[model samples]
Target: MERKTNLIIAFLLLICFGLPRNLGAQKEDSIFYKSYTTTNMEPWKKTMEKMAEELEPGNYKQLFEVTLAWYGYIGYCLGNDKEREARQYLKSGWQFLEQLEEMPEAGAAPHALKSGFYGFEMALARYKAVIFGPKSLSALKEAAAIDSSNVHYLVEKGNQMYYTPSVFGGDKETALRHYEKAVKTMEAGGKYQQKHWFYLNTLVTLGHTFEAAGYLKQAREVYHKIQNLEPDFKWFNEEVWPDFVKKYGYE
Candidate 1:
C-alpha cells in the first residue's frame, strides 16, 4: 500500500515538473508561428521578453530560438516600413548573433543569420549597399560551405537571388529554383510541422516569387496549399489573397 502511494506521488511529481519544460519548448515555436500567420506582434513581443528574462549563458538553443524570433520580428517591421523599430531590433539581433557566433554548437545557423542581418542593414541604408552587399553574399557563401543544404541557408540564398537587382545578377528563374529546392528539401525532411514557421514562410515566398515571375497558376496553387495547411493564416487570408484576387481574379 505504501509503495503504491509513493508511485502515485512520483508520477504526479513528474507530471508537475516535467510538463512545463516540454510545454515551454513548444510554446515559443507556437508563438512565433502564430505571429507569422496572424501578423500580430504583441504576443510575440511578450514571448521574446520572457525568453530574454529566462536566458542564461551557454543556453545555446534558447539563444538561437530567440535570435530567430528577433529576425522574424525585424523583418515584419521592415515590411511595414517601420524602419525605426527595425533598426532597434536589428541592433539587438546583432548582439545575439555575435554570441551565437562564439558558440561552436550553433553550427552554420549563425552565418546564415549574419547574412540576413547584413541584408537588413542594407535595406535600412541603401548607401551601405556597396559595402554590405558583398558582406551579405560572402556570409551566405560561408554558410553554404558549412552546410550547403541547410534550409535556412537555402532560404537566404533565395532571398538574395529574388531581391538583388538585375545589374547585380538577380534572376527570378534562379530564385524560383532555389525556393523550390528549399520547399522540397523541407518537405522531404518532415519539417512542415505545425510550429515550423520558417517552412510556411518559405512557401509564402515561393508563391510570391511565382506571382512576380508571372506564373499565376503556380502561385495560386501554392497559395491554395497554404490555405489548406493553415486556414486561419491572417496575412494570407486577409491581405495576400485579397490582393491576389483583386489583380488576378478569383479562380
Candidate 2:
C-alpha cells in the first residue's frame, strides 16, 4: 500500500512537470506571422475617417456636414457594389456641399474643400452614370465650374465622351480638346494636378491619344510605366491595366 501510494504521487508529479516542458519545447523555436488586412484604403478615405472622428457633428454642424459628405461620397465610390450607394452618397454629399457653399467655411478649410468638392462632384457623375443613364456630362461640367483648371477632370469628361453617341455631343475633337487642356493644365501647374493614380491615368490616356495621333513613343512610355508599378496598386491597375496595355502596346 505504501509503495503504491508513492508511485501514484510520482505519476501525478510527472504529469504536471512533463507536459509544460514538452509544450514549451514545441513552441521554443516556432514562428508566428503578423499580417496586414487584405482590404485597402485610399489616403483621402483614411484622412476623412480620422478627421470625422475628431470633430463634433452636433456642435460644428456645417463643418461636420462637409466632412460627412466627403466621407460618404468616397466611401460609396470605393464600395464593391457601389452604384446605388454612390447615388445615395452623392445626394447627401451635394446637400452638404450646397450648405457649405452658402455658408462657406471661412479659412484654410476652403482651399481643400474647394478642390475636394470638385473632386466629389466628378465622382458623383461616375456614380450617377452607373445607376441612371447619361448624367455624367452635366456633373462634369458642374465640377469644372468649381475648378476649371483641373486637367484630370477634363480628361475624365473626355473619357465619358467615349460612351456617349457622337450626335449627343461626344466627338474626338472634344476629346482632343479636353486632353490638350489637361496636358496644358498639368504643364502649367493648374488646379487639377496628378497624384500617382492621376499620373498613371494621364500616361495611359496620353498613350491612347498619341496612338490615335500616331505617336508610339508616348504610348510605349505610358505602358512601360504602368507595367513597372507594384501589383497591389489600385483597383484598375491590378486587373484591367495589364491586358489593356499588352493588347494595345500601352498606347
What does each candidate score in C-alpha RMSD?
Answer: 1.8, 16.2
lDDT per residue as tens, model 2, 1-251: 99999999999988898785445322321210000011233444444444445544343443543444364345446446665655665655655544554544333233334444444455556555444343444456555766655554666666655445688766665665677677666657632233333444455566566556555575566556555643444544554456555666544
Model 1, range 1-251, lDDT digits (tens) per residue? Answer: 99999999999998999787668868788888888888888899889878877888898988888898889888889999899999998998999999998996977778988999999999999999999999999999899889978877888898999999889899998889989998998888753564588889989999999999999999999999999999999988988889999999989
lDDT (C-alpha, whole model) for all candidates: 0.88, 0.50
Give the distance in Å from residue 104's predicted Cα in candidate 2 to where it truly belongs. Answer: 5.5
Stretches of model 1 off by over 4 angstroms after superposition:
190-192
For candidate 2, the lDDT comes to: 0.50
On TM-score, the leading prediction is: 1
Clashing pairs in 1: none
